[model samples]
Target: MAEPTERDPLIQKPTVFTDADSASRGEPATKQRLGPLEISASNRRGILAGIWLGTFLGVLTLVPTMMPSISSEFQKFHLASWLGTAYLLATCTFTPLYGRLSNVMGRRGANHTAIAFTAIGTVMCGLSRNMESLIAARFIAGIGGGGLFTTATIIVSDMYTLRNRGLVHGVASCFNGLGMGLGGPFGGLITDLLGWRAAFLLQIPLFVFALILIQYNIRYVTPGKSKGTMEMLKRIDYLGSLTLLVALGSPLFFLSARYNESLPWSEARVITPLILAIVFILGFLGVELFLAKEPVLAPGMLQQKVPVLVGASNFLVGACNFSVTYFYPMWFQVVMLQSASTAGMHLMPNSVSMSIGSLFAGWMMHSTGRYKRINLIFGIFPFIGTTLISRLREDSGPIHSWLSIIPLGFGNAVALHTMLIALLAHLPESHMAVGTGFAQLFRGIGQVLGVAISSAIFQSRLDAELRKRFHVPDAENLIRQIRRNSNYIRELPSEQQAYARDSYALALKTVYIFAACLTISAYLVRLPIPDQDLDKAHARQRAQAEARRNSTAEVATTNAVASTSTGSGLPTPEYPARSPTETETEPEEPAA
Candidate 1:
C-alpha cells in the first residue's frame, strides 16, 4: 500500500510529540508545577482521580433515586421534583462566579470552598425534617457542586496545551461518564438498603477524601501581581452576579409554579415572578455589557459567532441529556414495574456508551487537532436516541429499552467534548476561564430547564389522561396522588395499576418528543461553527507572544544605544534588526 499523504502541516510537526513522547518515556507530563507541588506526570493520576471523585459526588446528587420514597414520606409528591430543581437552580446560578473566583481566591481556595459547601449541604440534606428544609439543603450542596467540575476543567487547562487538551478532556469526560453512569445505580442501591437520607450521608466521607486530594495535589497561583484582599474583592462584579440570580431564578420559579403546581397563569404569584425574571434578564445584560468593570459574563465573548453557537448547543444538549438522566429510570420503575435498584442498573448501558463516545472524541481531536467533523456528526445521535425513546411502550422489551438510550448518551457526550474543544480553540488564553464558565452556565441552565419543563409536561399530561379515564367523584383526589408520587401507582388496584402505567408511559412519550426536538435543534445550530485547527491556533498565539516580546526588546536596545552614545564620540555597536517582511502586522485574533 502507498504511504498516506500528510495534508496538514501539524501532522508532520516534531514538537507535537513533546508531551506524549515524554510521558511514554515516563517523564513529567509538563515541566510546569501544579500549585506548589512539583509532582511528576505519574502523580497526575492522583490529581485526576481526586477531580473525578469530586465529579462523581456532584453527579451522584443529580440522579435522586429515592425521590419517590422521599415524596411519599413527606406526603408532598408535587414538591418532590423541587429537590432536584433546587439543586440545579443553585448550580446554574452560582456557576459563573466560580470562574472569576478561581482568579481571586486561587484554584485551591475555590476548589476547597466548593467541597466544603457540598459537604455541609449533603449533611443537612440527611438531617432535614421537612420537604422545605431538604430542598434548601440541596440548594446549598449545589452551590458547591457547581464549582467542582468547573475548577477541575480550569486546572486541567493550566496543565495541558491546546494540542494535548483534547485527550486530557476526553479522559476527564470518562470520569464524568463514570460518575453519571454509576450515580443512578449507586443511589438506587443506597436508597434500597439504607434509605434516601443514607445516600446523602454516605457521600460525606468521599467528599473529605476529594478535599484532601485537592489540598495535596492542587495549589492556587495568582495570575499576575498579587493584589490586596480588598482589591481582589472589588474585582468581583457583585451587581452582575446578583442580577443574574434574579434573572435565572425568577423564570424557574414561574415554571415550577405555573406548571408543576398547576397554578393559573394569571395568578399574581406566578405572573409577577415571570415579569421580574424578564426584567432582571435585561438588567443583567446591561450590567455585563456596560456597567461592571470586570463583568461576570463578558459581553465581548458572546458577540462572537463561536461562543454563541457553542453556548446554545450546550444548552440544548443539556436539556436533552439531563432530561433522560432524571426521567428515563422512572420509566422502568413506574411503567415496567421494576425496583429502584433495577431501574438504576438499566441506565448502565447509556452511561457506558457515553464514556466510549467521550473517549473517542477526545482521542480523535488530540491525535488530529481537528474537531469540526466530530462536532457536526455527533449531533445526530441524541436526536435518533430520543426519537426512539419517545416511541417506547409499557410492553417494550428489555433490549429495546436498553438500546434506545445509548445513542442519546453517546452522542451527547461527543457533542459536549467536541463543542468544548471548538470553543477553547478560538479563545485567547486570558479568557479561557470566563469563556468556559459561559459554556457551563448555559449547560446548567439547560439541565434545570430541561427537567423543569419536562416535569411540567409530564405532570400536566398525566393529570389530563387520568381525569379523562376516570369519572368517579374521587377521581380528582386519585389523580392528584398519582401526579405527586411515583410510588402511588403500585398501591392501586390491578386495573388501575395498568391504567396508571399506561398514563405514565404516554406522559413520558410526550416529554421525550420534546427532548427530541431540542436535540435536532442543537444539531442544526452546530453547523456554522468554524473549524479552527488546534495546533495552528496555538502556533499563532505563540507567534504573537514572541512578536510582542521581540518588539519590546528592540525598543529597549535602541534606547540603551542612544543613552550610551549621548556625548561620547564612540561609535554605537550594531544591533540585529528585522526586515520589513518580518515586521508585517498580523491579523487580529477573533475575540472570544
Candidate 2:
C-alpha cells in the first residue's frame, strides 16, 4: 500500500512525541517501554485531565443534595424535580455533539469550551433568584459538564493504550465517585451554614483550575483540523445536530410534563412531544445514514454489534444508576424522616463502595488485561442490592439501608466501567471520541428515563394509597401537603404518620424493583461480549505503526540510491529480499 502523503486526511502530526533532534538536547523520549506496557512521558496530561473532569463532575453532583433546600427557599417545590432532569437533558443532548466537536476541534479546544460554559452557568446558578433561573442555569452547565466528561474520556483514549486505559479510567471513576459521594453531604453542610448559592459559587474556582490544568498539560492530535472558524462550522452536521437536539429534548419535556403536571400520558401536552421526539429521532438517523458529510453519530457505528450492545447495556446501567442516586436521598428524607444533611450522610456507603469497586475493577483489568468475566461476575451485585433495597421498610435501620447499597454501587461501578472498556476495545482509535460520547449519551438517556419512570410510579402509588386510606374532605389537601413537604409527616398523628411512611416505602420499593430488573437486563446484554486481550491488541497496533514507519524509511533509502547511481554512472546495488523476521522487509511493487 502507498504511504500516506502530507495532504492525506489520515496523516496526523504527532503531538505527544519529541523528535530525535529534541531528544539529542537531553529531552525525555516521547515513548518509553516499561515491561509489556509502553508509557508516554506525557501521560501526566491524561492524569490531570481526569482529575479536572472528576472535580467538575463532583460539583455537578452537589445539585441533588441541594435540591430540597432550593425547593424550600424558592417556594417552587414543584419545579425542584426539574433540576436534575434539566441538567441530564442538556447532558444527553450535548454529549454526542461534544464527541463530534472534539473530533473536529481537538480535545483542548472542546474541553475549554465546555469549561467556559460550566463556569458561566455555575455563576448564573449562584445568582439566580428563582427556580426557573436555576433550572435554566443547570441546563447550561449540563452542556459544559457533558463535554468535560466526554472529552476527558476521549483524552485518556488518546494518551493510553487499551491495556492501560482501564486503570486510568478506574482512577478517574474514583474521582467521580468522590465528587458524587461527597456532593450530598458537602452540599448539605454548605447549604445549612452558608446557603444553597454557596454550593454553586464554590465550584467556580475549581472549574478555573481545571481549565488551566487542561490548557497547559493535555495535548493530542486534532482529528478534524480546519483552516479557520468558518471552515470548522462548515464541517459540522448542522441538520443532524438540530434533529438530535429535538429528538432528545422533546422526550424529556414530555416526561417532565407528565410527572410534574400529573398529566395523563394520553394528554396532548405529553403525547405531542412524545410523537415529535420519535419523528426527530428518525430524522436524525436518516441524516446520519444518508445526508450529512460528517454525521455527528457515524452511520457505520450502528452496524457494529459490539457498539450497539455496549450502548444498550450502558443505557440500562445509566437508568439504574441515576434512579438510585436520585431516589435514595428521597427515601431517607420521606420514609426515615431524616433532614437533608442527614440524608446526604446516609448515601456515604454507596459512594464509597462505588469508588472501591471501580478501583478494584481497574486494578483487575490492568493486571489481567481481561474484563468480560469481571463484568459478568460483578454484574450480579447491583441486582442483589436493589432486590434487598426493594424490601426496605420504615423499620429498616441505618445499617440495613446503608449496607444494601454497597453491592449495587460496587456492581454498577464494575459493570459500567467494564462496558466502557469493552467499547473502546471494539472501535478503531480514530472513532474513540465518538464512541465514548455515544456511550455517555445512552447514560444520560437512562438517567432521564429512570428518574421520570420512578417519579411516575412513586406518584401513582402515593396518590392511590392516600385516597384509599383517607375519606376526609381534606384528603386531597393532605396528600398535596405531604408531597410538598416530607417533613410534614412528623406533625401528623402517630397512626397517620405510620401510614404515610408505609405508603412512601411501598412506592420506593416499586422503583427499586424496576432498577433491579434493569440491572439484570444489562448483565444479560453484556453476556455476549467477547473476551479479547487488550494488551495483545495494543501490541498489534504498535507493530502496525512501526511497520508503516519502516516501510516509509526503506522507500526513501531506495529512491536515494537510485538517484545517486543514475547521476554518478555507478552500478546500482541489488538487495536480496528480507525474510519475515527482518526488521526492514522488501516493499511490495506499486499497484497498476
- Residue 200 CA displacement from its true place in model 2, Å: 1.4
What CA RMSD would you report for each candidate?
Answer: 10.8, 8.1
Which predicted model would earn the best TM-score? 1
TM-score, per-candidate, Cα-based: 0.86, 0.83
lDDT per residue as tens, model 2, 187-218? 87888889989988987777777777777655
Cα error, candidate 2, residue 496 (Å): 3.5
Q: Which ten residues in a row have the lowest lDDT in candidate 2?
A: 583-592
Alpha-carbon lDDT of model 2: 0.72
The positional error of residue 198 in candidate 2, measured at the CA in angstroms, is 1.3
* Residue pair clashes in candidate 2: none
